[model samples]
Every structure is written in C-alpha cells, then in structure tokens.
Target chain A: MMVTLNDARRVIAAAETKAQEIGQPSNIAVVDAGGNLVAFARMDKAWMGSIDIAINKAFTARAFDISTEKLGELSQPGGQFFGILASNHGRVMIFAGGVPLRKGDEIVGAIGVSGGMKDQDIALAEAGARAF
Target chain B: MMVTLNDARRVIAAAETKAQEIGQPSNIAVVDAGGNLVAFARMDKAWMGSIDIAINKAFTARAFDISTEKLGELSQPGGQFFGILASNHGRVMIFAGGVPLRKGDEIVGAIGVSGGMKDQDIALAEAGARAF
Candidate 1:
C-alpha cells in the first residue's frame, strides 16, 4: 500500500549490496512519503560531500514526482516554473543521482546515493530499486 | 543496515506512484549524499512553484542530518549552531519535506517531495517511503 518501513529497509539492503558489488564506497539515504528522513548510511570511502547530495536527490524526486533531469530541461529560459524556486527558497540542485520508490502507481518515498561518478551513483540507485 | 543507492530509487518510485494514486498531481524530488539534485517529476497538472521547493527540501535534508523543520528550530539567534550555514554556504533551505536516508546507524542520504500542502507534502513523502 505504501513505502513502508519494511520497504525502506529492503531498499537500503539492495543498495548496499550493489555498492559493494561495484567496489565503490557510497552514502545512501531514504525519505518518507513526505520527504522526511527514514534512514541513512555512508560507506567508508564515500566522499563526505556525497552524503548531502544523495539525500537531496531523493527529496527532489519525491517532491516533484519526476526525475531531476526533467527539472533541468524545465529550468531552461522560457520554460515553466523557472527561477521561481530561487525566489521561493534555496537548496534546489539540478544534477542527477536520485530516484523514487513506488508501489503500483502510488508514491511511497524516495532514495538517494552518492560516492562515485554520476553514472555510478545512478547505476547503484537503480540497482537498489530493482532489488527492492 | 543503512540507506543505499538502491534505497534511493525505491523511495522515488513509491513517491511517484502515491502522487498518482492521490489524484493530487504532485512534484517530487530526490538527492544524493552530496545534496546534488537527482530524480524529479512533476505530475501532469502539478503546480510550477511546488516543484522547485520539493527539490530544495531534498537537498536540505541531505545537507543536514536533522529535518528542515529541525534546521529551522536551530536557526535561532543563539542556538548551539547559529547562522553558520549562511557563512559556510548559500543554498540551504530549512523546512519540512526533506529527510535523511539511513541503514541501521548509518546515513546514506535523504529525500524531499513537494506539491500539495505542506502536510500533504510530508504525507506523500512518507507514503512513498513506506511503499518502497
């Protein structure tokens, strides 16, 4: 029915296994349906900066219900809802690496991970989701 | 035991599905451990403003271990940690929606989702997390 606590745990487990498989340390984070923190983790060699980035990605995906990539395209000049985020608030990063958690058309929550290249981060996150 | 990249993906998927089920057309966001933007999606008819706010929420969550609401509480004039975030950085929002990812005691990252009211924002984020 939702991205329950049990689901969150499953996501983390899968992500960890993927990170290890890739031979790269990582930091992963999870948020509730409302983007509230549910859990977190950081591997030994993960960059300190990656931790924050990972969390933001998860939140962004959950809040927007779309990939951060879309945000970038929309941010371009003449696009919709541009620069409004700056006026409304700060903390909007237009990169990539975060993904969402779902259950048959229902929004549950989201996850974010960092510690390697952008592609690696994305791969790991996707891997974690697939595992779940 | 901690949040992982896989965990990040699952969270977003759940959040997306929840928004759809609610019929609320929402904006969701996710971030990586470094607070970088990752995945984001805006429902077919979601508001333009709520989208960016969602991403920022995610970034804030990843950047701060505590919730954005907690960050707001700590932003007091003489709190243990004052406006240091201002001096240290420029884009840090303190509000709800953003939350951390964790595995046991570990912190992987976090997530943030918007669209819908503040309570709604939090509600959906939680739902997505649970679903995943």
Candidate 2:
C-alpha cells in the first residue's frame, strides 16, 4: 500500500520537535516504499537549498539501503562511487541527517533533515525516529 | 517510524531482482523517513546519467510528499508556474519509476529506479516495492 497521511504527520511532528530541541531549523521529507513523497516541511531559518539536499539524502538512503552518513564514510576519497553521485547529478549530500523508516523489519520509507550541521541533523532525525 | 535497515536491504534486493527480471539494468535509490540514502545500486549496464535521476526521484519523494510522476504532471501546462520551478537548480526528473514506503498509514520513506523507460522503470520499482 502507499504511505498513509497519518505517518507523514507523525514524521513532521517528530521532526519539528527534534529540530526545536536542537535549536536548529531544517527541511524534513518523508516518502513511501515506492520512493514517492508523502510529506515535507521547511522550517523557519532552514537552509534555502537544503530541501534539495535533504530529499537527496533520503533518496540515497532508500536507494542504496544504507545511511547517508555511511555514504559519507565510503565517500572518503575513493570508496566506489564516492562523489559519483555528485558527478551524476551533483545533489548528493553524504553528510549525516538522512534516515530510513521501517515496519516490522521492512523499510517502508525514509526521512531527511537539512539546514543544521550534518551530525546534529542526524541526531535529530534519529531522535524523531525513535519517538515513533 | 524510521525506514529501518531492513527496509534498505529489501529495496536493494527487489531493485536488483526486478532489473534482472526486466532484462534491463537500472539505478535504484531508497531513502528513509529523514530523506537519507538508505540503499542504492547501479546495475552493470545502467546508464550513468540515470543514477542521479534515480536518487533524485527518491529524494523528491521524501521532500515533496508527492510522486515524481505527479511532479512531472504538475510541470506540464500552467498547473503551478510549471517551468518556473525548473529554474530551481533543475535536476527535476518528474518522470515515473519513483515510489514511496509506508507502514500501516504512515509514509516511512521512498524508492526510485532509473535506466529503463520511465514507465518501465517505475513498473520495475513498483514490483520491487510490492515484494517488500
């Protein structure tokens, strides 16, 4: 089935809370198993172009089945595609803050937050994810 | 809820299987609730230009709360200033083949695939998504 609106609201709520707690604004995105967007939020003071980055992060996570942060890890100099994403379309954000969603061991969707420091963004996303 | 690691694996597995099944090499992307890159794969014969499109599809999914196909639909005619949006950094592939993830009634993340015809790509991605 498609990702329901209810989950989209939850993701946004959690993102807001985490962002507020961190005192950092961000752009949050949520999509379904088919990689379709279900919800999104661009908080005040968030980065202008971050929406693209956030979405890319989430997309990367779901597409590769790994953490965007990990992509950063592998991106270290030469780890395969390292920067290949950038070369491909130039919107790859290997930094932290992008995460995935699941239902009983199934990655039904994902979330991406942008604007704050990569580490902080990741922490906030993780916090929000755990809350659900 | 977050797109769990399990979801990433499923996305990748399904993508690869579908690509092979279709006799088409493809680039697939999956993002988390946070819009992070969860999983990605570039089939041996997939077009290099397609990777970014695949990931962007997933990213857009998480960022816009809509389908890339729908986004394309909006780009047509004068729906919402159409072409004006393309000015925003432009890598917008409003084509199909991108879908989202959900748990019950929540959108956890999304998935995107590229390389084959847009419709075929979306169909393959959908096949993979349903497998989950």
Candidate 3:
C-alpha cells in the first residue's frame, strides 16, 4: 500500500515536533515509491532555499532505496556512485536527512528534512520515518 | 495557505476515484505553489510515459496559473504563447488535464492527470482540484 494522506501528515507532524525540540526551523518532504512528492511543509523561519533540497533528498532516497548519508559515502571520491549526482537532471541529493519509509519489507515512500546541520536534519528525518 | 500534504492527498484520491468511475487508470500528479512535486499516484496499468506528462502538466499549470487547455489554445500557431512549449527545459505541457488549485483568490497549487483521453484527463483533474 502507498503512504496515504494520513501517514504523510503524521510524518510531517513528527518532523515538525523534532525540529521544534531542536530549536531549528526545517523543511520536510515526503514522496511515494515512484519518487513523486506527496506532501511538504516549510516551517516558519525555515531557510527558503532548503525547500528544494528537502524534496530532492526524499526523491533521491526513494529513487535509490538508500539514505542520503549512505549515498554520500557511496558517492565519495573514486567511489562507484561518484558523479551520479549529475543524473536525473541534477535532482539527486547526497547529503543527509533522507530516509525511505517501509511497510513491512517493502518501501512505500520516503521522508526528507533540511534547514539544519546534517546530523540535525537526519535526526528529524528519522523521527518522521518512524511514523510510517 | 499552502496546499499541505493532507490537501494534496485528498486531491489525488478524488482524481483516482474519478478515473476509476471512467474505467481509466491514470497517472496523477500534484505540485505545490512553487511547482515542486507534492504527491503522485500511478494507478495499476497506467501508461508509464504518462507519469512524466502528468507531472509536467501540473508544473506548467502552476507556472502559468492557467489550465493546460487554455495554454494549448494560446499556443496554437500565431497565438501569444505559440513557442512556449520549448521553454522550462521543455517541461511545459500544452494540453488538457492541468488545473490550478485555488484557496480564496490565491492559486495554491495544481493537479494534473494523464493516461486517458484529453476530455477524461480534464474531468479527473477538475475533480481533483475541487478537493483543494
């Protein structure tokens, strides 16, 4: 099954809560199995430029079925996935804060967060993914 | 007000139901005010190529704040937007099935439907936009 409206809203709420606890405004995005966006939220005072980054993070996660951090490692210098970021019309994100949401064993969707440090973004994203 | 995840999902669901009633599996896409994808659904057996078409349609609608059908009319030979099809990296769609979602007097987002005839696509897309 897909990530319904209920699930996406729950994840966005969870992410927002985490961002609030951390005192950092954030942009959150959710995309389906096909890497299509389902929902997004830009918190008050969040970095406007990070909105696209958050969306791309979620798309990258769903496109590759891997977290952005893991993709970063794989895309390091001389790594197999190096230069892969140029694909998909330059929409691939290789930083952090993107995670696939699973239903049992199948990947149903993904969550991405931005407008904070890498670790901070991942923390919020992880919290959101848990709501899936 | 932005089209939240809840809003996008409701639109998609409405579009899906309309497509089902017409016996046509469709690819549906929703984009936020900035023309970024918010959610997408590709019904089982929907035409794969239509996925991108649906997405571009939504983007185009949001970009111009006009229905694709209207855009198409204006894009005919000797019309004002005749050459607009080659703009935005060729992502513009000039056809039916794309409509802006409005909140009060504001254009909040847009919905696009593909995988059916132009009339069917427009009908489903209209049903979706009304959900916003």
Candidate 4:
C-alpha cells in the first residue's frame, strides 16, 4: 500500500523534530510508492535551494527503492550507476538524506531532507523513516 | 515577509475543503514570494499528472505576480506575452487555478489547484486565496 497523507505528516513531523534537535533547519519531502510527491515542508530559514533537492531525493529513493546514500555510492565516478543523474529530468538526487519507508518487507514510500550536512540530513531522514 | 509553512498549510486546508465540497480530488501547492514551494499535498486519487501542473501553477503565479489565468490570456497568440511559456524551463503554466496571496497591497505568495476542470480549479484556488 502507498503511504497516505497522514503517514507523510507523521514522517515530516519526526524529521522536523530531528532537525530541530540537531539545530539544522531543513526542507523535508515525502513521495509515495508511485514516486509522486505526497507532502513537503520547508522549515523556517531553510536553504531555499534545498526545496528542489529534498523533493527529488525522495523521488530518487522511491524511483529505485534504495536509499539515496547507496545510490550515491553506486553513482560515483566509474561506478555502475554513474551518470544516472542525467536521467529522470535531472530529478535523481544521489546523496544522503533520502530513505525508503518500509511496511514489513515492502517499501511504501520515502522521506527526504536537505539543508544540513550529509550526516545530519541522513539522521533526520532516518528518524522520519522510523516513525513510519 | 514571505509565506511560512504554517501559512501554506492553512491555504492548502482551505483549498482541500473546497475540493472536497465539490467532489474533486485535487493536487494543491503553495509557493512563497521567492517562487519556492513552501508546501504541497496531493489528495487521494488525484490526477498524478497534475502534481507538476499544480506546483508550477503556484510558481507561475508568484513568478509573475499574476494569476495564471491572466497569464494564460496574455500568453495567447497575438497577445503581448505570447510564447512566454517557452521561457522558465517549462515551469510556466498558463492556465486557471493559480491565485496570488496578498497581505494588504503586497503579494506574498500563491496557491495552485489541479485535478479538475478549469472553472473548478479556479474556484478552489480562489477559495484558498480567500483564506489567506
């Protein structure tokens, strides 16, 4: 089953709480199983440029059903998925902060966060996923 | 000041209420004064294709400080702004369902609605703008 809007809200709330705990304002986004945006939030004073990044990160996570962190590893220079960012109308975000949401063994959706260092963003995203 | 995430939520809520009253599942988006998306929601069973359209409609409204319906009229053949859609990386949506949010005389943001007929979209957008 796809993630519902209520599920997305909970995910976003958890991510926001994590960002606050880390003192990092963030842009958070959720995308459904179909890779369509379900909900998004830009915390006050978050980097404006990160809005697109956050949303695309979620899309990338669900697009391949893999964490964007792993995708980043695979898309490194000379790696198998290198240049993959050139596809999906440039919406493939290859980096941390994108995590797939799972229900039992199936991926239901994804959460993406931006506006912090890689580790911080990843932490926030993981926190969000845990709430799902 | 630009629109905040809280403001975007209120706007989306109003638009969603209007959509429900009219029996239309809609994609709703809100953009701040900088034309950056503040928040977005895709109602259950909403047209997937309209997700992009809804977001861009809000962007187009804020980008030009004009309702997309007005922009559509201007972008028509033989109009002063004909062919303007070719610009903005195809983010310009020249159609109904986009309304600017105003504070006093200043434009602060915009709301966009999709997943319905032109008139219905406009009505929903107007409902959102009214709430702002």
Candidate 5:
C-alpha cells in the first residue's frame, strides 16, 4: 500500500505534537512508497534551510528502506556506504531525523524532520513514523 | 568538457548584474554538462524557497537540452508532454528561468534563475546563459 495524504497529515500532526512537547519548532516531511513528497510543514520559526533537508531525508529513508540514523552510521568514513551521499544528486541525507513507515514487512513510506538538534530531530521523526 | 567553476562564476555574476539592474534579488544556479551543480548564489533577501527551484531548473534545462519555459508549454494540460513533471524524482521543473548554455551547437551546460516573476527570471537566466 502507498502512503495517502491523509496518512501523511496524521503523521505530521503527531510529529508536530512531539515537537511542541519538546519546545522545538521543526520542519517535517512525508514521502510515499514511490519516494514522492506527500505532505510537508515548516513550523513557525523553523530554519528555512531545513526545508530541503527534511524532504530529502524522507526521500533517502524510503529510497534505501532504512532509518537515516542507521544510514548515517554506514555512510561514515571507513563504512560500507561512505560515499553514498554523493550518489543521489545530493539528495541523500546521511543523518538522523528520517524513519521509514512500514506496513507489516513492507515499507509504505517515510518521515523526516529537521530544524532541531540531531537528537530532537530523530525523536520527532520517530514519533511521526510511529504514528504511521 | 564540462562547465568549469570559473565559467560558472562568470555566468552567475552576469545574471546577478542583470537582476540588480532589474531590481530583483534572485537565486541563480549553474549546472555542468553532466547535470551536476557547479555553482549557486542567493541574493540578499531572496526567498529561501527558490534555492531548490533555481538548482533544479538548471538541472531540468540540461537534462532536456531545452529551456524550461519551452518545456512548460508542452507540459501544460492536454499537451503532448503533460504530466512530465511527475517524473525525475520531482526534480524536473517545467517552468521559466531555465536556459541551456550552448557552444557551437553543442549544449555545454545550463543556468537557472528564480525569486522573481516569470519574465524577470527568464531574462536573468538568459543573461547568465549569454555569459556562458
């Protein structure tokens, strides 16, 4: 199944709630199974630069079918995917803040968050993924 | 050969000059023959949202070997290439402000401009392409 706009909205709402709870304005994005953007929101005062980063993070997560946190580890120097970030026309984001949405064993979509510290972004993204 | 950094700078500078003359702060980008970004500049007070658009417009021009303005016409509803924007991982921007850079009938690169109206962006991109 694909990620519907309605599904993306619910995920974004949950991430927004978590961001509010943590007192961090964030940019959140959702991508469908085809890695196309489904929904996005930039909370007031969120970093403008993070808009691209948030969308690409979700694309990277769904493209590789892995959490961006794990991808970041593997993409570090001396790791298997060390140069992968340069492969996707600069769209791959090897960092925290991206989590895949799964339906059973199938990846249905992904969520990405930005405009906060790495930990905060990860937490917010995971919160969104869980909502999915 | 691909577009060199020096050439990209010259193109951006020319575009910036034109933008200044027209009183429109803008985002400008250049891509090499391989469709990789060579350079980019966002003028003071330019819309952050145009950064991605500027870069992708350059990419689209080079990818199609035609101006995005022309492509936009063919991509309109009921046109032969309608719905083409849904391709290219959402990077194909079928709109104004993208112009191919040519050398002796060979397309060597492209320039993209944004953060202004359609005519302004087109004029700015043309200025950059002329420089190239």
Candidate 6:
C-alpha cells in the first residue's frame, strides 16, 4: 500500500511539534514510495529556500531508500557513491533530516525537514519518522 | 490562509471520486501558493509518467494563477504567449487539467489531474478545486 494522506499528516504533525520544541521554524515534506510529495508544511518564519530543499530531501530519501545523512557520508569526496548529487536533475539532497518510513521491511514513504541546523533538522525528521 | 493538509486531502478525495466515476485511474497533485507540492495521490493503475505531469500542471496553475487550458490557448503558435513552454525548465504544463484553488479573492493553491484523457483530467481537476 502507498503512503496515505493520514500517514503524511501524522508525520508532519510530529515534525512540527519537534521543530517547535527546538525553537526552530522548519519546512517539512513527506513523499510516497514513488518519491512523489504527499504532504508539506512551511512553518512560520521558515526559510523560503528550505521549501525546495525539504521536498528534495524527502524525494532523495524515498528514491534511494536510505537516510540522507547516510547518503551524505557515502557521497563525500573519495567515497564510492560520490557524484550521485549530479544525478536526478541535481535533486538528490545529500544532507541530514531525511529518513525513510518503514512498514515492516518496506519503505512506504519518507519525511524531510529543513530550515535549521543539521542536528536540529535530524531531530525533527526522526520525530516524524517515529510517528509513522 | 495556506492550504492545509486537510484541504489537500479533501481535494484529493473528491478528485479520486470523480475519476472513479469516469472509470479512469488518475494522478492528482496539489500545491501551495509558493508552487510547492502540498500533497499528491496516484490511483492504482494510473500511468507512472503522468505523475510529473500532474505535478507540473499544479505548479503551472499556481504559478500563473490561471487554468492550464486557458494557458494552452494563449501559448499556441502565433498567440500572445506563444513559445512559453521553453521557459521554466519546461515545467510549465499548458493543458486542460489544472485549476487554481481560491480562497475568496486569494489564490491559495492549485490541483492537477492526469493519467486520463484531457476531458477526464479536467473534470477531475475541477472536482478537486470545487472541494476546497
């Protein structure tokens, strides 16, 4: 089954709560298994630039079936997965704050958060994923 | 004033019902005022390639604050807005299946439908926009 609207809302709500707790306004995006957006929210005071970044992060996580932080590590200089950033119309976001939503062993969707420090974004993303 | 998750889901639900009535599986996309995806749905058996088309249609409608069919007419050869497809990285979808979602005089978002004939897509898109 695909990621339903209910699942997307749950993830967004959790992410919003986490971002509020961190005192960092954020842009949150959720995408289905096909890397298509399911839900998105731009919190008050969030960076407009982070809107695309958040969506791309979710798309990248769903496309690769891996956390973006892990992708970033593998995409570092001299790494095996390097240069993948140039692919997919340069939409592969190799950064923190993106994680797959698992149903059993299957990745049903992904959530991405932006407009904060890497660690803060990761925290909000993790909160969102945990809600799923 | 933004199109919330509730609004997007309601629109998608209405669009899905209309597509079902027409016996056509469809890909639906909803985007906020910033022309960023807020939600999307791909009905079972919908054409995978139509996913991007659905999204671009919504983005185009939101970006220009006009129905895609009107834009299509205006963009025809020798028309006032001809050759506009070469712009926006070819993401501008001038077709008959995209309409803006309005809140009073404000254009809050847009909905797009694809994976069917032009008329069917337009019907579903109109159904979605009316749900808002």
Of the candidates shown, which would achieve the greatest TM-score relative to the real structure?
4
Which residues of candidate 5, in runs, are more than 4 Å off? A1-132
Q: Estimate each model's TM-score.
A: 0.50, 0.52, 0.71, 0.95, 0.54, 0.78
Per-residue lDDT of candidate 4, residues A46-131 (tens digit): 99999999999999999999999999999999999999999988899999999999999999899999999999999999999999
Which stretches in model 4 have alpha-carbon errors above 4 Å? Answer: none
Q: Could you tell me the C-alpha RMSD of candidate 4 in Å? A: 1.4
Model no. 5, DockQ: 0.03
lDDT of 2 by residue, B1-132 (tens): 377778777877887887787799989888876666877889897899988889878877666766788887887777773773564365456778778777777777888888988777888778767755
For the predicted complex of model 3, DockQ is 0.17
- Model 4 DockQ vs. reference: 0.83
Candidate 2 residues A1-132, lDDT tens each?
Answer: 345778777877888897888799888887666555777889988998999888877766666666788878888776876665655366566878778777778777777778888778887677656644
A1-132 per-residue lDDT for model 6 (tens digits): 488766887898999999888899888988888888766777766787887899899999999999999999999999999999899997899999899999999998899999899999999999999999
| lDDT, residue A116, model 1 | 85
A1-132 per-residue lDDT for model 1 (tens digits):
356677777888888888888898988887777777677889887899877778877777676666555665665433343332352344444556677777778656778887888778788788767755
Alpha-carbon local distance difference test for all models: 0.67, 0.76, 0.87, 0.93, 0.93, 0.89
Fraction of native contacts (fnat) of each candidate? 0.08, 0.00, 0.11, 0.83, 0.00, 0.19
TM-score of 5: 0.54
Q: TM-score-based ranking, best first?
A: 4, 6, 3, 5, 2, 1
* DockQ metric, candidate 1: 0.06
Higher-ranked by lDDT: 2 or 6: 6
Per-residue error at A8 for model 4, in Å?
1.2
Residue A109 of model 3: what lDDT?
A: 88
After superposition, which runs of candidate 3 have C-alpha atoms over 4 Å from their true positions? A1-48, A62-65, A74-82, A101-110, B1-10, B32-48, B77-79, B103-108
In model 4, the clashing pairs are none
